[model samples]
Target: MTGTILTEDAGDGVRIVTLNRPHRLNAIVPELLDDLNHALEAADRDPAIRAIVLTGAGRAFCSGDDLKDFGTQAADEPGTRAYIERIQDVTRNLVLGDTPIIGAIRGWAVGGGLEWVINCDFAIAAEGTRFFFPEIAWGVFVTGGVSELLPRLVGLQRARELIMLGERFDAAQAREWGLVYKVVPDATLRDEALNLARRIAALPVGPVRDLRRILARRDALAPAMAAETDATVRGFLDPATAARIGAFK
Candidate 1:
């Protein structure tokens, strides 16, 4: 367990990784991302840990990036690239890593938060959980391999509408759109997620891990993640992005 990321052994080879910035609605900041990457790496390397439930500490799973602090990280090109890369690394660890991660999504999962939701092996959203990508409106590009994953999850047309329009969708709609594996009562979200993880952990680890690896197809993601990084960095460095994000603030 760390200040920004909390790790709890849920027994039965399941680990619960909770985003710990509840006061900020678990908003993304550099420190939080760094801690999250390290925590995820540790869990993945541990042989005893068979499944992980990824969630947030408070009202929202993640309210996306801390807008007030976002501009400074992207003040220059190199800085922008590095910051975006760090964000992408979380997705890499979640999707390409050996351990399976199930998202216990609650409340708002906006922008990059939504990207991480998509990155999960599968997600279980709580009732009333809201999701959307506001990057386009803010003149920034979507990251976390959403370009490659979302189109495949939903159809190309639906992906375009969600990304381009930046409209919010509820948990029920997300399930209908195939974004979430299931939706549970908000009260039992974490318990349900942990139960699901326990079920996965009880399975033969070798076959389960093999299935995750085969299905993840790490080889195909290199180009997609690279393209996402390049595009997102460019968006962050754009003058229009500064104006748009500034106005939002």
Candidate 2:
């Protein structure tokens, strides 16, 4: 593990993968996305790794796309498409890979960050963590198959409200909406996630693998991903959206 992604062996066949850009709140840059995708793929192929605890270093799990960095990529169609594809690659690894991932979330999990939270096999959020999707307001679409997954998790009406309104919700609301598996104290979030991963590692590997495969067998996922990529790439290239992103920078 190198660059924006860090890996640690926690013994018992469990590996801890941390998004290491603490200075920027682990915001999604192209490099971060690339490093994360590679890290996930490596873990998935390693038979010695039974479970993965995915977390971020610093005050936030992820602050979403670094609009400043991402905005520059939007200057051209090819850069825009490649960037969105890299984002989708992370989702593919998390949702389709053989290794089970447990998200240890805290602080802000906004936009794409929140989408990754939803992509986790099951996430454990800290009590005060904040989550939201600002994509609609910014003229971009949600990716990571959130369109399909959110509706299934929180019902269609609630999912619409979340993405359309782009409102911020706390861990309690996330739990009520079935977004997170459990909410733990901020101080104990990492420990709890690792303990859970350890337990998962102790389970029978065959059944665990089967369960992961069964749950992720969503036929709608591929189509949703394709649609999202197209929409998001177009959003990035839109003049109005570029202006909005520029103002933020």
Candidate 3:
């Protein structure tokens, strides 16, 4: 019962999860978030599936939250809080879910969309892909363990600059910053990602899953997720931030 995302089995313990809302550039909404949460967890729990590939359906991987819906959502603080909780739920799975998740990114990966790319176990991006963290500029705060994870990926100074400046950076820079593990030509993005996922899936499941767990900062993730939830709710409800979101609409 997939909704905003399409799921396909790639065989040999690999599953491809596609974000389906091409018209909206697969922007984040409660439905999409919930779908991702359910889909990702299901893949992780399926014993035959060893790896998951997450990609977007159209031009952009994701353009972040659907600002059109955000303006109305922020008007109701409880609605805003619940929406972010769903977003964090997806993030939680990305961070702790057993199946290795690889992100195949192309086009715009902005705001919360960029957070997904960051949290993915190993991200492969098209050369033309662009990413940015727009929370600061939008008068909102970071979520998805972004504050801790970004710094771990790109150093505290660089993460601070990227978060505070909210400027767009290309795939090459992202690769150099260690946020992305690989960068391929636009025409081959999906193929390359699929190949990588298949290769990872071919490895012995126990060792692979164990290695992932051993590498993960399990102790850090929970606190970071909790902090993100609190900050996300606070930012969404802040009058000034709501005003900014309102003005954008």
Candidate 4:
């Protein structure tokens, strides 16, 4: 699959989805969201695609949502709710779909970018990579389900520090926090992710999917619910949020 937002291919029963907006650090835009949903659906439908790898071009995995486009007329127009809904749908699919997703991250994964990584079934980061959730600083809360995912990955207190303070964590720190499955040298990030994907692909699909579903159910009940609620409250009060709201109005 090829689109303005992404490129994809299937090999050895694994699908690799590459975010193509290098200049923008693979920031989420409406078009990108659409393309990503389509690509994910395609991978889920293909029996040959037992695993999926999501990565970005250039240095950064993803910087977050494209702020320039976020509150623009196009994004806030009457039918814009559909686009937002589509983003949520895509993320839900990623979490619930049977094909395990491995995030191959390098450089920065911030805000919605980090949300993307959190939603993946597994993640591996380059040694020098940085992860952060700066949505609070930007005057918004997470829209990509980070509130539900972060605490499960890093626990409550750590999640608060990251989201509330909008602090950045290095690859090593992320691994220690249990956010990343592994940290490799920058040069080996892609290779490591691919190797992990291959390992997952080699597993029996039924069992693998069952494992994911079980984990998701377990995580969704307590910590995930609390964090999500807190995030929703904080997002509207974020400092950088006014500009976007103003633009939308």
Give the Å error, residue 177, model 2.
Answer: 0.9
The sequence of per-residue lDDT tens digits that candidate 1 reaches over residues 67-163 is: 9897697789988899989999999899888898999999999988999999998899999999999988887888898988899899999999999
TM-score of 2: 0.97
Give the true-structure RMSD of model 1: 1.1
* Model 1: how far residue 96 lies from native, Å: 0.7
Instruction: Give the count of colliding residue pairs in each prediction.
Output: 0, 0, 0, 4
lDDT for model 1: 0.91
Off-target runs (Cα >4 Å) in candidate 1 are none
lDDT string, candidate 4, 1-249, tens digits: 346455456467877888888998888777787788888888899898989999999989988877676544133334444554565666677887888999999998987788878888889999989888877666666656666677777788987899889988899998888888899998888788888888999999999999988877744544553454445444444435656556654
lDDT scores for all predictions?
0.91, 0.91, 0.87, 0.76
Clashing pairs in 2: none
TM-score of each: 0.97, 0.97, 0.95, 0.86
lDDT of 2 by residue, 1-249 (tens): 358999999999999999999999899998898899999999999999999999999999999988768557787999889889999999999998888899999999999899999999879999989999999998889999998888989999999999999988999999998999999999999899999999998999899888877787668888999999999999988999888877877
Error of 2 at 21 (Å): 0.9
For model 4, the run of ten residues with the poorest summed lDDT: 71-80
Off by over 4 Å in 4: 73-80, 218-240, 244-249
- Any idea how many clashes model 4 has? 4
lDDT, residue 25, model 1: 89
**Which tens-of-lDDT digit does each residue in 1-249 have in candidate 3?**
457989999887899999989999999887888888999989988999988999999999999988888666676767878788888888878877889999999999998899999889899999999999888887787788888789888898899899999878999999999999999998998888889999998988888778778666778877887887777777777788867877877
Q: Which scores higher on lDDT, 3 or 4?
A: 3
